[model samples]
Target chain A: MSKQKAVLSEEQIKTRRGRSVALAVTLGVLVAMFYVITIVKLGPGIMDRPL
Target chain B: MTMLEQTQGLHEDATDLGGRGSVSDYIALLKPRVMSLVVFTAAVGLVMAPGNQHPILSFISILCIAIGGGASGALNMWWDADIDAVMSRTKKRPIPAGKITRQEAFAFGMVLSFGSVLTLGLVANWVAAGLLAFTIFFYVVIYTMWLKRSTPQNIVIGGAAGALPPMVGWAAVTGDVTLVSIALFMITFTWTPPHFWALALVKNGDYQAAGVPMLPVVAGETATRHQIVLYSLLLLPVGMAPYFLGFASVFYGVGSAVLGLVFLGYAIRVWRVREGDAAKKTAMSLFKFSLFYLMLIFAGLLAENMIGLV
Candidate 1:
């Protein structure tokens, strides 16, 4: 069987890329902020917590 | 335009408002303005709680509360889309505007609600999670679905959902609500009637068109204005309960007292003046001041607690 090529409209591709980037950035920020706050709040013994 | 006709334009875009949904549309569905108040009050609740929480947990708790608030707003928008479409004020909302499908908004709200509650449960305690869940149910199912269209006393009773955020925040930090948190809830609870009624007085037609039984629509402006004065008078003492209970400093008490009088003054203006543009203008004034009234009162509490002035 012939393989079907992936086809997407330019606008669709752009939207997909934009949404992916936004979601990735949001998740990254949340994770980073959580860790940063954990360090700030927990202080030098941050690693000692059950986290 | 008639209510049905007003919705025709949004309906024509069956493809939906502005072509397609974007991140911003989702944000709008969450009612960012409302969520800001929720976040601020919740933060104030967390701060005023008796003990210190780990800062990370505190951040997570606030985030979860914000998510819960946003989720509830989305659900309200989802269910209220039909009424919303008919109203000029809400005609451009995600579902009504035709940008997001009702099904999409409902699913989005469901996911966020469950995610927020589960995250809060995992990261903090179940008490706060339970409160958050109940808040979503109260606002979405009880307030929006049951009370909004059926009764003139809708905002009076439904106001409980909006007033619960501080208690949620207090629970998040302390794992239990105390007398002080109850006092905080009371402040917002009492404040809601006048705040919403002021807007209802201004936009009575929208509610009438939507078949929503807002007090101003059902009771006539005169009666609704009377109710505003009554609630404002009630707020006089409830606003100062924090100070009287020794949770706030005398300075904050004086500030709250001053704010209460100013709020009462605006409500009294709406009560006594009813013959001209001044009537709507006075309602608008009370509406505007009530927004600042809550922000300033809550901010004062936050400052007093953070500074240990109480």
Candidate 2:
């Protein structure tokens, strides 16, 4: 059903490809950053091994 | 169709905010079977801990553990999306199959990770919450991103995070660590290689194709099987530790002995066969039995605690 939709021009295709790639890369970076910050913040508390 | 038409389709997908995909797709991304084992083992740890948590707090604590486990799965799926797309078994996962956007998965994982950790700290104790947070980070960043591609020992080290649930449960109750809880952690730690290597043996090609650096991919099948036997033997002694240490009763002792023996028998058969139909059959059988072995050992702990018939 969705496949029956009208197609776009060459310039539109190029722009769309660029946008999705950008979105994916942005998400990847954000998630990685979130974990890194969380770890750095929580490291002292979590990694405190009893001497 | 022109290149323009293809690009437009892409834009439509990107902009289609109203088109929420199937709920089943998101559930598939959680890797429910893996989550189930995490929940069960963590629960056993909580239940068998030396002290008791208030019922409401205990419920919240376990809920956090489950969510934390799911969060780890989500992040793992997110990072391994490329390889997941290539492998047949995992190709249908949410991100790989395009059932859910990568952005959505990342968001889901982050929210759950933060919520579970914060809630655990408030409802249980900071120690347990802290451990849960570290487990999520280690699995997602250290193991999934780094060791997985770099070395064959990925699972060996990564398995630590997997093994910590019970310790977290124990910590939730007592607000501190103990020898007993660490021993529980060690049991799962030792069991992981044999448990995973068996699957790696069966799915060697998948790892090879994905360049996963799995033990069976880097080490030969013979070596992997031998290691499985070694870990199985070591686990036998470790499995019986609770009984010997007076942490559990004779029922647990009997159950551990039987389960460990069966696990050893399969591992030995896998080691001896060396190749062909017989080897594959043994490897797969060992893989299936390994799950039962883990569950039974923990179940025995719960039963002994409940019955009080030491």
The candidate that wins on TM-score is: 1
Off by over 4 Å in 2: A1-51, B1-20
Residue-level lDDT of model 1, residues B42-82, one tens digit each, is 99999888787877788888999999999999999888888
Backbone collisions counted per model: 3, 5
Q: State every prediction's TM-score relative to the real structure.
A: 0.89, 0.81
True contacts kept of 2: 0.00
Please give the C-alpha DockQ score of model 2.
0.03
Supply candidate 1's per-residue lDDT for B130: 97
TM-score of chain A for candidate 1? 0.68
Q: Tens digits of per-residue lDDT for model 2 on B55-78?
A: 756876887898899988988987
CA error at residue B7 for candidate 2, angstroms: 18
Q: State the local distance difference test value for candidate 2.
A: 0.82
Task: Please give the distance, in angstroms, between residue A50's alpha carbon in candidate 2 and its true position after superposition.
Answer: 37
Q: Which residue runs does candidate 1 get wrong by more than 4 Å?
A: A1-16, A29-51, B1-19
lDDT score, candidate 1, position B267:
96
